[model samples]
Target: MLNLKQIVAGYGPAQVLHGVSLDVPRGRVSALLGANGAGKTTLMRVLAGLVRPQSGSVEHEGREITALPAPRRVGLGIAMSPEGRMVFPTLTVEENLQLGAIHARARRGYRERREEMYALFPRLAERRRQTAGSMSGGEQQMLAIARALMARPDVLLLDEPTLGLAPVMVKQIFEVVQRLKEGGLTMFIAEQNVRQTLEIADHAYVLENGRVQLEGSGAALINDAGVRRAYLGM
Candidate 1:
């Protein structure tokens, strides 16, 4: 559903992505795997229209969106939960979620979507009035993802969604990812949790030095000799 072709992006003169290209199929989870500074997050930023690529194009469905701004991208069915779970700390959980539906399209049935989010994350339901800053790390992560889904995005961009959560919390978050996949939500996840990411992703790509070094079905990557040695430590 989303296609990025020969993308070259960076900060000022320091280029980070060097001709990166990938596809995210509709209703499937596509994992972008890489070590730190591999440009995974940069690619996500490009797709979300937060970073303008110097060259190459971002196409959703069949139209180019490379020139679109961040807010326009959100209106066009793209939403991102950034790397740090940048939730508004001072805002209540419900208020944070409400902000996600600010786009006119998402505003339709906003109340219903809020209820759905509460159902998806029962903890948030219980703490709807609690300040986001007061929530635990795991709860915060849930709130982050829940907030993104409130926009009813056609494709969700998740950058390091499980970054620093405990093992149990990581498992819980992945379960939610699985549930979203089952619900036919198209997602592009940039993650470092190799094993868990591959287990849940339909397809996966490994990035090295801002380039795609490997691409394959997630199960195949799981059993790949190189992937096992490098990522799985097997």
Candidate 2:
């Protein structure tokens, strides 16, 4: 559903991705794994239209969207839950989620989506009226993902979904991802949690030094010596 070719992008004079290429097919979870500074997040940013690529093309469903603005990308059903779980701290959980409904199509389904979000995340429902900053780290993470879901994206880019959460919360987030995958939502997941990512992913790409070094079935990459040595620390 998404194709990125020769994506050269970075912050101010330092190009991080050099000739990077990857494909994310429809109805599958594609895992992008890399240690820090591997251009994983940069790739997601480029896809989200937050950071324009220095030179490359990003196509969605065979339509060229590389030059489109970020809001247009969101309108095209692409949403990214960034690395830091960036939710509006002072806003109530409902308010934060409401912010994600900026897409014209999404706004039409706002009430239904809000209830769906509450159902998908009961914890958020319990504190829907509470301020986001008051929630625990895990709850905040949940709120972040929930808000992203409020956009009802076709291809959700999830970056570091399990970053600093406890094991239990990580498990919960992964479970939600698995459910989304089962529901046939195409996703590009950037995760440091290798074992779990491989377990749930259909295909995987290992990024290193700003390029994809290995791309294969998740199970295949999981058992590969290179991936095991570099990522799993096994």
Candidate 3:
């Protein structure tokens, strides 16, 4: 339900994405796979309205939103859980969730939504009053995703959700993503973990040097010689 066309974006004069284009169909998981500096994160930022594109357009459902501000995009059902799990260290778990629902639309059923998030993440429920800073990296990542879900977004942008986490944690995080997919959440995930990502992705794109190098159905790409050689070492 989201589309990007020839999107060129960057910070200052260093352009990262060179006319990158992709589509995220409704109720499907779209994976953007690349190693470091492939413009994966930049593209996610552009989609989230955190970075204004120098050219091209971003359309959601059918409406152009390239010029819209980040907060406005959030109001339009776009929520991003950034790369670093940037949670408020000083805030309690529940408080961070409260901040996520600050927007009027999300605030409508805050209590019920919080409970839903808690159900999705029982660990958070147990540590509801604990400060975010003291949590483990895995727990922090869970909090980041949970906080974004608090907004009740239509499409969730998950950027490197498993970055730097333990192997077990990575598995858990992917399981959570799988559950979200089963529940019909439209997601655009930027990740380096190819195997697990492709396992759940409906469509996948391989990005390199700020452009799409390959795009195909997840199942198709998984067996692709190029993909296996380059990423899976098959």
TM per candidate? 0.99, 0.98, 0.99
Tens-digit lDDT track of model 3 for 1-234: 899999999999999999998999999999999979999999999999988999999999989999999998889999999999999999999999999999877999999999999999999999999999999999999999999999999999999999999999999999999999999999999988899999999999999999999999999999999999999989
Give the C-alpha miss distance for residue 39 in model 3, angstroms.
0.4
Tens-digit lDDT track of model 1 for 1-234:
899999999999999999999999999999999889999999999999999999999998889989999999898889999999999999999999999899987999999999999998999999999999999999999999999998999999999999999999999899999999999999999998999999999999999999999999999999999999999999
- Across 84-116, the per-residue lDDT of candidate 2 in tens digits comes to 999999999999999989778689879899999
**Could you say which candidate leads in lDDT?**
3
Worst 10-residue lDDT window for candidate 1 reads 68-77
The residue pairs that clash in candidate 3, if any, are: none
Clashing pairs in 1: none
lDDT of 1 at 4: 97
lDDT computed for candidate 1: 0.94
Candidate 1 segments exceeding 4 Å error:
none
Q: Candidate 3: TM-score? A: 0.99
